[model samples]
Target: MLTEINFDGIVGPSHNYAGLSVGNLASTRNFGRTSRPRDAALQGLAKMRLCLDLGLAQGWFMPQDRPNQAWLGRMGTDMSLATAELRYAAMSASSMWAANAATVSPGADTADGLCHLTPANLVTMPHRSHEWTGTLAQLRLAFANSASFAVHEPVPAPFGDEGAANHMRLCSAHGQPGLEVFVYGLQGGSFPARQHRQASAAVARLHRLPAERTILTQQSEEAIAAGAFHNDVVAVANENVLFTHEQAFADREGLYAELREKLPQVVILEVPTSAVSLADAIASYLFNAQLVTRPGGGMALILPGEAKATPSVWNWLQTLLSGNGPIRELHVADLRESMANGGGPACLRLRVVADPATVDPRFLASADRITRVEEVVRKHWPEEIAPDDLARPGLWNAVASARMRLLDALGLAEL
Candidate 1:
């Protein structure tokens, strides 16, 4: 019963393009280091708007962060300027619906909540709660309730290095009757050299979730290739297990073909050829795809990638949602640098509960049709604030200025 869902976004800074960030193998600059201000602003704007739209449609969006931000910085990090970038994006998303009078609940009020994983906060492999405080605040405003924040315990050190933790992969939330499946790998430290038995034991105690739900896939010893793996087969939806074929690792053409052949029922998107390694491949998938299940259906399929090179995947998506399913596309030509920095549409958003009364169906259209929250402000505000204005200090200054202008234009008095 696995059903395919398609989601598409133009490559921009906001959408994390894993292919670009995986070690210059693909020859793209890191997003943070890009000199083009326009591209950055566009990517940022597109991503923030996209997150809002997707959150409205799916009722949830999860954003992950880790402590390795510092390490990544030292090791040539060029993606997000700060964890606050993600936070800011989430705030913009909720505020858009709120300002537009859309029916959307804040994360704080929902039974299911968004998880922000951070380093130093590790108790579980990915360190799932550094930004909990800020995340909670956004949820509260969106949902007006405190039920939204779910701070998972820190991932154990033995499970993986900071990179591995950041790459925490989502496995099938279904299967094994009441068990949640999660697959992660060990990237740095002695942990990768040792078997993850200790890490498994630690996860069992921390989350109170079953240990069987956790699957650890170790990095390969050879030249690291994207999506390469050994025997470690973990279920994704119900019966689908993601495995790596050796030949696929050796031959990109073969890997692409195999993915198409194996995932016919689902959409198989080839991460742009620009993408480099398994880690980048997985990150690209997590940052862009969503798990959408229709009411009454028990299975789901990962949506295919939208890059033109992956025509089969795109066609499959079009075919799947051709009829009744709602589809929205957002084009963010500006985020090229951000994707280079590492993050896609999903990484830039934080999902909250939905409010049926305020939800706008048009907002659910693809990126091309949906009006960006920033663009709305620019168009409706009484005064013009150039994108360069964002570079100034006093972060809320621009936001407050824009808000006042918007309210004035609407002829509404300040509350």
Candidate 2:
């Protein structure tokens, strides 16, 4: 049976409060504040351990090589001449949000019986644009068995991709053939629309997904304008259940009708507009919560602490829990460091549907490994980083040294 394994990105030593993301309110609001990279990495590691303790498969993706000298070289810019923004962009720990790692089509959904992965070319933001190459290399090394996996290079530029954060699969079971939903934003208004129709179509075609099982739906412009930079900010799916806001799509009725017609087993849970306004939805990030099937066969909503703080969302959540539904439980994870930068628990991971035995052992999580990672983070990670600190004289060496310690501890120094 295919298993959904969560590969969480280990927060990097360069994690800082730069407020680089344009549409993310939290990021903007928290700009110039002091960030605790140590706490951030520790919290992320704790979440991974929690998942593992709960009998879920957990893996890890390391941060991209920061203070990226190679990328700086391409622009003919060096530290001596680089501005604070330029340095921060290169050293951005944004790669800790691994949901944007790649678009994955499980073996069950492909024509060749091989799982396919395509690294995203996040051309929408300069800070994110340099991530694809490193992400591809990691995917290749992790899922390199050609007999069972196919990791494709990113789609050409001009066709921007934001990876699985904008895609979801709904199947009867993990091993079964599922329907793939590609959410594309037609317009961003003042903001940048990250996912492109051309890129989504290219990935679908490259994966050899059956035309009848694939669907492309346009994300509502209102959602994008309201800081739903990626579709996950407003909608998400797990198994056959789709949990979304009423304003999440361009044509909600048509999309549901199509899903019903094409995949009769699909179950949709749409939060009404009156219950929670789009603003609250984006602020609370209720849709970005992780919906996972528990060990007892019921599903739980693993929400961030922000959801509990929002009155409207909390009230709605209580009502949702009172009802007889598949989602019967809630688990709150305090990912405040990540949440401050517009990333919740869901944003920190990339899901891969595969058998645990099939994946590389090094990527897999265990109690011993988790403890070791935590120890390394505590020992070497920076306790506080501010925007101005990005340009500090020895900041690059400190970040590099801390990262090396983490890589060595995780046995991922080769990466």
Candidate 3:
């Protein structure tokens, strides 16, 4: 059975590298002139590398558009040249730049995939320029499972807005005979348009199939701007429809209560308050309420700020993967001045696939046990070089580069 899921791991400098920044760069809205360019480049490289690594480590294949690009040479063993090119094109287009340009494409392999496109609609127009590249990539990775794949089109306009899309709130799926949910933002003009009614209608229609349901929330006025409100929240899995009523922008406990009432059999946990941020909230909503499977075969309640607030989130994730289960997590960091402008971790990637058997649970387990990344190198790579060599940024890069060579020696392909 398929048992692993790919997720967007943390994006930031390599703790040892001083020049990398993770996430969307175009949406910072307040980037200064003095931002580090090298760091930005490194960050971008890291993000790209992560995609390639995930594909390799998990045996998952990425769809691409450009096979000639040297970056993808290492991936040839698994990914077809045609698929790689397609993915690259799609990712480049879904980047922050295209989101703002309001340009549309069918999405290429590497140069023109969902990473570069936005749903055509009103609610998403204002934030159209805001890119959620990273989040999309994560969603693609999650959906890359080797079971069933389906794309939900004409996603709700309101929910398709920049913020929601960045959080993967619109189109997301996982597992075989996959579960795909497409969100439509309420449209029809007038600030904070009453699109929920229309959105609800669309959702009902989307879930009309034999094994489908909808999820809705009553969000606060402030949160509503973020499109966090809905009337009835439903999730369909294993031919079961789970429903719940949520108060958007509610406190952690309030959110938990709603989830408990809707899916009482599942265990719910409130994310720590310290991790609360707009990005964290959106991710929590999507993962906890929408996608994650609870301890008891029901939806899990993940309060908005819990994942960021506590390291326990990682610990819990580790526990789940230890047994070959599918799970995903998102973490946000502040990157005000990096290449591409500025944004959180969710805005720099695009989706390409969501297959579980393709993923290796060991990677997730490694991520969970890793308290200090340096330890990863120590435990995984002890002979190539001494740990002190990685202390310097330039030296660290050299070490990283050399480590890549070691990976190649061990049959690890470069991307």
Cα RMSDs, all models: 11.3, 1.0, 13.4
Alpha carbon deviation, residue 326, candidate 2 (Å)? 0.6
Model 1: per-residue Cα lDDT over 303-322, one tens digit each: 22322224433443455445
Worst 10 residues of 1 by lDDT: 94-103
lDDT of 3 by residue, 1-415 (tens): 3232323322222221111121221322322223332344234334434433344222211111111123334445322333522222222212322111111111211121222222223233322222232334433343344234322333344443332321122112222222222333332123242334354344334324222322333334434444332211111111123222122333435544554554444333323334343343433332323233432343232222333444544454445445433333332332323222333232332222333343433223232233233333343322321223323345334434533543343232322
- Can you tell me which runs of candidate 3 are displaced by over 4 Å? 1-38, 44-123, 126-147, 155-197, 200-204, 207-212, 224-258, 271-342, 347-353, 356-415
TM-scores for all candidates?
Answer: 0.42, 0.98, 0.38
Give the top-scoring candidate (TM-score).
Answer: 2
Q: Rank all candidate structures by their TM-score, best first, as comma-separated numbers.
A: 2, 1, 3
What local distance difference test score does each model get?
A: 0.30, 0.89, 0.30
Residue ranges of candidate 1 with Cα displaced over 4 Å: 1-28, 31-56, 59-133, 139-178, 188-204, 212-288, 294-306, 310-338, 345-415
Model 3 whole-model lDDT (C-alpha atoms): 0.30
Ranking by lDDT: 2, 1, 3
